[model samples]
Target: MIPSGHPDAPKLSPLKQLHWSKVPAANTRKTVWDVSEESIKLDFNKQILDRLFCSKTNMSRTGTHSTLRNQDKITIVDMRRSNNIGVLLSKYKLTGPWVVDIINSMSDEHLNKELVTALIKCAPTSDEEQLLQSYTGSKNILSPVDQFLVEMLKVPKIRERLNCIQYKQSFDSLFEEIINGSRLVERCCQWLLKAANLKQLLHLILNIGNYMNSGTARGNATGYRLNCLLTLSNTKSLDQSITLLNYVAKIVSDRYPHLLITSDPLLEAASRIHWKELSNHLVSLQQGMMTVQKEVERQQSTVGMDTFTTKMNQFIKSRLDHLRDAANIIRGVEQLYDTVMKYYVEDYSSPEEFFSLLHNFMTMFKQAHLDNLRDMENDKAIRPKIVHKAERIMCQRSLSTTSLPRVSLNLAPQQEENQDTVRSSAAAAAAAVGSNSGSSIQTKSKGLIKNFKNIFLRKR
Candidate 1:
């Protein structure tokens, strides 16, 4: 695959090289005319000049405005043709830079696509068969515009200008990000190695982890992988009510609160660093550097220590040397991190991996610490209310226990009176019924008494 922003020139697509051939019309009437090359060139130049300066008034005076406006209008076509645009270029003395300037002056909206299309007519081929048929029919192609573009590409300066127009903005932004991000990464890595508080915090984490894993076979492992830090919040007690990270946060708060913010810079660096974008940026910078080097080499050969190219060469060399130094620093930072991780009984293979682990742990640690402080504040606010509710419950239980016996004693007489009343009602019902229906009346009275007892029990 071609590297992005490379110095090597791009190959022209197949459409640009299409071979257009003449197709004869059967109904055309033969006519004799004397058309000289000079007249033809003059006519072509006049068309260009007229188009550049033409306005509505001129078109109206020439009686061609209606032909231009109407879709169905048929007018006489220009019959003059050429195999190349060399004659026009020679007449105008238009060099590669001049062509580039014209192209650049056009709006970018049309420059990317429309300009190329306007210069030539693409051959119509829907499939391989059609393409093969086109190839068989035409070997001498009419591609004057394509030939012009090809000639311009032969000039290094023109080619560079074209490449810049296409890719300059994106490459510059990417390279800027790479340079800034390398500095941040290197700084973070250095801080990680030298910061005393960070080392102490890691020690605390290691001790707590070992204690938690005391009974397991892996408890005494000499080292850990950086990724294991992400599971700090997931490690739970037997009851699964809280996490290891929460406990760790509490310990840090009670003992060493300063370490809580130690990972902030590291976390920020990790978040801002984009591994894939950085890698791609570096590759592109290398390619762009190669392009500049090639251009400088060309200038050195042609002009020999000219002011413009000499300054450009110096700038490129200095920046390239700085970039190379950054690459070396990055390598050293990775090595230093691996060493530190190994010392702390951990292993990490990449800066991205190491920084990601630290970032996740730092995030979880901050959240857990904040949650712990909030919980403490809530407890302080509601402690009195909880105590008051407990006291009220105890007082009600004591009152119920002390008055329950007196309450029972007072209800004993009432229970006797209710039994007497029930007996009198039963006698009345029995007297109202006949001796043969006495059994049914007795059963009815018993049900009524049971319902009354249930009601009294419920009320009590």
Candidate 2:
């Protein structure tokens, strides 16, 4: 048999190993396992020596390089353990070519808002920066993600660029909120000033209230407070079946059916805004601009900070103009709000309060209108029943009072024939009485129905 160490030796199977002891002693040779084990030990020793030599070379090149700081070591360890850099690269689909383009340009315009925000969260620390700056190892030894970060750190003032991007994003969001809120406030004010149907409805309410309070000290009042609208549901008829608001709704439906004064979506959106909240946002925006200005001034002398400062200067100039315009809009909104409040004789502390009160009043009015319609429907359905009952009662009474002609069967045939004629005449008279009673009952029922409706509308 060929020696186990021969170049052409077949690999030993389990069966071959089991039968090895049965082979002749003269042909015996070392098995492949012993040679393979010795080769593995030699390879391991060589790898250790190579690593030591590389370490010595790295130290000699750096000339007594300082040991990795504790923080730096921890950062590196965490990077290795979590692979967060890899995650970020994968999440943003940042290929090597795209990353190189970004690093070379040093421009964040290609990055979306979300990606920029994420990068801010994962910004490299100073410890990581030192480590990356001193790193002299081959790029192949580092991960693709780490290599990307190393290249990115080569750009000067990258952190400043990111901060500028963040500031712009924040300014945009805050400005948009302020602008939209101002527009909504403006719309609400315009609606209040120009809504003819709303004015007419208020006038009608005032007239009705004055009429109801005719004999009291409240009589002949020129106007009522807007909040007084809330009390309409509390004022009820003697039987408590209908409220003053219900009566008002009925009047409106009859006299001005087209008036729907409370259905403005702009008013609803305005009611949700708090003036104080908007004012705070405005202040924050101004403060943020001041901070940006300070940053730009501080960085004016920085060698590589020119791009950031220049861009910030332009931003400040343009946005300052916009900020001034926004401030004017806020002031205009406040002025309009105050004007509307004074016009209505309202004493609200804020626009939100004023609009919320109006919103509540509208809700109550809509409910009352629906209730009035339902009550009217019920009244209509019951009216015919009342008239029919009245006619039936009248017919019964007339039949009971009328007498039938007496029939004399024991008398002669001529007498019987006369009785028949009498019967026919009595029947005709009764039919006439019934018809006349029905007509009179119909007239009475109509009067009763009118009185019933009046009762619901009558003041206590």
TM-score to native of every candidate shown: 0.50, 0.60
Residue 116 miss distance in model 1 (angstroms): 14
For model 2, the superposed segments whose C-alpha errors exceed 4 Å read: 1-86, 95-100, 103-109, 126-148, 169-177, 194-225, 254-260, 297-300, 305-312, 385-460
- The TM-score of predicted model 1 comes to 0.50
RMSD of every prediction: 18.6, 16.3
lDDT of model 2, residue 214: 100
lDDT value for candidate 1?
Answer: 0.55
lDDT of 1 by residue, 1-460 (tens): 6642233423211122233664455433352234556557763343343344433222466545332221121111112323234455555555545555554453354444433332222111124223323343222232443334443443334434344333333445665677677667767766766778766777788787787689998686555665677788887878986788888889999988887853576556665676556766677777877887787677678756644355555567667775686567556655665676765555554566667777777787889999899989999989999987875564334323322221232346546556545444434434433332446644654454455445456444
Pick the lDDT winner: 2
The sequence of per-residue lDDT tens digits that candidate 2 reaches over residues 1-460 is 8764344554221111121336565555575443465576663343333333332232346554343221111123244523876787778876555654563454657766787676654455666668767778566546566666666665555565566667777888889899999899889988888878878899999899888889999999999889888999999999988899888888888888877555567888899998889988998888888887876777676654555567778889989987888899999999998899888888788898888888888888888898887888999999999998986775454456455556453545544545554445445545555566666645654454344334323411
- Count of clashing pairs, candidate 2: 0
Q: What is the lDDT of residue 234 in candidate 1?
A: 81
Clashes of each: 2, 0
Quote the positional error of residue 184 for candidate 1 in Å: 0.7
